[model samples]
Target: MAKSDTDIPAGARRRLLALAQERGASLAGLSELLGRNPSYLQQFIRKGSPRKLEEGDRRTLARFFGVDEGELAEAREKSYGATPPLGAGWVEVPRLDIGASAGPGALPAGEGAFDAFRFSRRWLAEHGLEGARLSAITVEGDSMEPLLNDGDEILVDCTERPFRDGIHVVRLGESLMVKRVASAGGGRLSLLSQNLAYPPVSVDVADVDIIGRVVWKGGRI
Candidate 1:
C-alpha cells in the first residue's frame, strides 16, 4: 500500500503552506493554477492523500514559487542534503529560488536561498562587491534578449543605493522583474527591455521596489 501524505515527511507541505500564506494565495487557487482540480492541493495538504507530489507537478510549483525543486521534500531528501564546507579563500553566495521575469511579470515568492555558488574572495574584492550582500537568481523570460536570455543566472548586489541607470531587479506591485532602468525625470523611471518587441513602461520611482543591481550573468552558450 502507498504511504499516506501524513505518514510522509511534511517539509514540502510546510514550505508550500508558508509560501501560500506569504503570497496570500489560497490552496484551491494555487491548485487551479497548477491545472489541477480546485481540491487537488487542498486534499494533498489537508487530507494527506497523494503521499508524494509528482515530479512534473513539483517542478511547476518550484518555478511558480521561485524556489529550488529540491526544497520540495522528495528532491530534498534524494539530493539536497547537507552542503559541504567551502574551500579556503572561497565565499558562498546564495542562489535564490526566485526568478526575475524578463517578460510580462512573475509573481514574487519564496525569499529563501535554495542553493549557492562559491566565489573567490579576491575576485569579489576586485569587483568592489566585498562584504556586499549578493544573491543569484534565474531569468524567466526573453524580454531582455541578446543581453539576458531565458534560464540565465544572474548575480545581484543587494546593497541599497540611490537609483542609477542600469539593469536591475525591481518589484512592481506583486510582480518581480528585471529590466533596464533609467531615469525619466520628474521622479519617474523607465523600465526598458532589450527586445524591441516589448515596449518600455514608465512608472513613479517611489512606486517600485528596487531589489538590487544585476552585477553579472552566466548561462548556456
Candidate 2:
C-alpha cells in the first residue's frame, strides 16, 4: 500500500539516523542537540518502516548534522541516482547578555553581572550548534578591542568545552573576559590578551568555569 502524505519512508529515517551517528551523535545526543524528547526519538526510529520526515523535522536534523539538507535527503535515494532537493526550514539561536565577567579578585554571582541579547534561531542552527542553548551579550570596553571591540555581538554556547588554544568567552569567578586560552602548568590554564597591555592571567584549574567557546563574533565599525 502507498504511504499517506504524513507518513515518511522507513529507509529515509534509517539513512538519517545513520548520517547523524556518522557525524558523532548518539540517539541520546541527538535528542539533546535537537531539544526533542528522547523517548519520542527512540519510538520514531523503531518503526518497522518509518514515514517521511516532516520539512521542519528534516531541517532540524540536517542542521544538527552540519550538512546541507539535500545531502541528508539524497542518502536515502541513492538507488535512484538523483540529487535530493534542498530542505527549506530554519530557526534562530538567541544570545544572552552578560554585563561583565568577574574581574580580578571578584566574587561570583553578584547582582547585575550578566545580560542577554536576541538573535535569529535559524541563523544559529545554520552554524554547527543547533541543540545548544546560547545566550547573547554585548561586548563592552576596549579590553578586547580591535579584534572584538566593545559593542560587538557575541553568541555563547555554554555546553561546549575549551580545548587547545582558541578564542573563548569565559567567566572567571564573577568577571567575564574574552581571551585566547593557552597551556599554563599541569592542568591549569592561562588567559592571554592580544592587546599586550593586559598580562597573561594564570588561573588555578579549580577557579575557572568556562562559560562557552566563542564560535563567531559580529560587530559594526
Candidate 3:
C-alpha cells in the first residue's frame, strides 16, 4: 500500500530533502551511500513509502550529515505541541564569538557567548562526551581547507588533558589558532595544516597553550 505525505513526518522529510539538495546529492547516490537500492530514498521522500526512517538508517544519515540523530528523527509533536524547549533532553552549548584561525593566526577577540546551539544529551553520551565542558567557535582562514574550512563551526571540548595527537585550539602569545597538534619529539609540537600550501610549524611545547580539543565540526554545504 502506498503511504501518504501525512504518514511521514514533515520535519524529517523536509530536513533530509534540504540537506540532500544543499550537498548536491541525488536520491540515488544517497541511497547507495546507505547501502540501499537506488530508489530507496526516492521512494521514502517522494512516495512516502516508509512513513518514517528506520533507526539504523537515521543514525547513518545523521552521522553522514554531521547532525544529531534526533534532527533526522520524527519530531515529537505531542511533547511540546511545537518545537521542544532546549531543556528537554538537550544541552545548550555556547557559541563563542571568536574565530580560531586556521591560517597564520587570529587574535582572540570578543570572547563572549554570542549564541548557543542545542545538542541531544543522548547523542553526547553516545559519543563519550557527556559532562564535558563544550563550546563552539568559528574557524578562520584557508590553511585547514578541505577539512576545517573558513566559517565552519567547531565543537571544542575544554576539559583539560595532557597533550596528545589531535586537532586542537592552541594559543601562542596573543593569537589563537586551530591546527593538528602532533608531537615533534624533543619536547616540541608540530602544528600541521590540512592544506598542503601551509607548511607545518614546529614549536616548543611550553610556548603553546592548549585551549581545547576540537571534537566535531560543521560547515555549510
Among these predicted structures, which one has the highest lDDT? 3
Each prediction's whole-model lDDT (CA): 0.80, 0.56, 0.81
Q: What lDDT tens digits, residue by residue, belong to model 3 across residues 74-135?
A: 64311111212367589888788789999999986566676788889899889878777788
- Candidate 1, residues 62-141, lDDT tens digits: the string is 88889886677643333211223367688778777778999999985655577798989888889998777777889999
* Model 3 regions more than 4 Å off: 1-88
Top candidate on TM-score is: 1
Clashes of each: 1, 31, 0
- Cα RMSDs of all predictions? 9.2, 14.2, 17.4
Local error of candidate 3 at 195, Å?
A: 0.5
lDDT ranking, high to low: 3, 1, 2
Query: How does each model score on TM-score?
Result: 0.61, 0.49, 0.61
Segments in model 1 whose C-alpha atoms lie over 4 Å from true places: 1-88
- Candidate 3 CA-lDDT value: 0.81
Model 1: lDDT of residue 82: 26
> Between which residue pairs do clashes occur in model 1?
66-97
Candidate 2 residue spans exceeding 4 A from truth: 1-88, 101-126
The TM-score of candidate 2 is: 0.49
| lDDT, candidate 2, 1-221, per-residue tens | 64442464445566666775577667776665567676545555666323444445656887777766555443332211111122344334443324433123223222221323434546656786655645455566565656777678666665544466776766675466677777687889998766667678998876675656676778786
